[model samples]
Target: MGYCRSKDLDFAFKVFEEMALKGFKRNEVAYTPLIHGLCVARRVDEAMELFAKMKNDDNCYPTVRTYTVLIN
Candidate 1:
């Protein structure tokens, strides 16, 4: 989140990938900030891809905030 907040998306993406590699449960909480950061960085296509992946995850789903991020 600090990475995302700081707009350091390269490190942010590294951390995101690390979470999956380390077997951390990827949930909405995990996906949202990266989505937000990507959106902030004008990377909407990547953000949408991530959102699609999140939706495909059995344990993950979009929240109101997630939709809000996309719409904004």
Candidate 2:
């Protein structure tokens, strides 16, 4: 999470992958940090991928805050 806040997407994704493999339950709190990091790093495509993954895989619907970050 700190990694994500620091805009370290590579590390963030690595951690995220490991967590998923270990059955860490994802919620909006988890997704938001990564999404915000990706956006801050200007990796919009990767952010969108995360967004899609959140919806499709994790069943975590996005919030207005998420959309707002992605949009602006």
Candidate 3:
């Protein structure tokens, strides 16, 4: 999230991937920041893709904030 806030998306994505590889249970908390960062970076397509992935995950779902981020 610090990475995202700093606009260091490459590192942010690296950390995101690492979380998965390390068996972290990625939830909305994990996905939202990346989505927000992507949106901030004008990478809406990638953000949407990530959002789709989050939606498909059995244990994860978009929150109101998630939708709000994307919509904004």
Candidate 4:
């Protein structure tokens, strides 16, 4: 999140990938910041892809705020 806030997406992604590799269950809690950051960075296409992945991903449900973030 700090990384995302800093707009350091490359680092954020590395960290997120590490978390996933370590078996950390990445749900919307994790998805939100990345998606929101991507949107804010004007990379909405990537954000939308990530949002869709959340749907296919097991146990990862997007919150209303997630939609709001993307929509805005």
Total backbone collisions for each predicted model? 0, 0, 0, 0
- In model 2, pairs of residues that clash are none
Candidate 3 wrongly placed segments (more than 4 Å): none
Which of 2 and 4 is the better model by TM-score? 4
lDDT of each residue in 1-72, candidate 3, tens digit only: 899999999998899899889989899988999999999999999999999999998789899999999999
- Whole-model alpha-carbon lDDT for candidate 3: 0.95
Clashing pairs in 3: none
Q: In candidate 1, residue 63 scores what lDDT?
A: 100
TM-score of each: 0.94, 0.83, 0.96, 0.95
Candidate 2 residue lDDT tens string, 2-49: 998776788988988898899987877788889889888888898899
> RMSD of candidate 1 to the true fold?
0.8
Worst 10 residues of 4 by lDDT: 53-62
State in Å the error of residue 68, model 1: 0.4
Worst 10 residues of 2 by lDDT: 53-62
Q: In model 2, how large is the Cα lDDT of residue 26?
A: 82
TM-score of 3: 0.96
Q: How do these models rank on lDDT, best leading? A: 3, 1, 4, 2
In model 4, the clashing pairs are: none
lDDT of 1 by residue, 1-72 (tens): 799999999998898899889999888888999999999999999999999999998789899999999999
lDDT per model vs. reference: 0.93, 0.84, 0.95, 0.92
Give the top-scoring candidate (lDDT).
3
Descending-TM-score candidate ranking: 3, 4, 1, 2
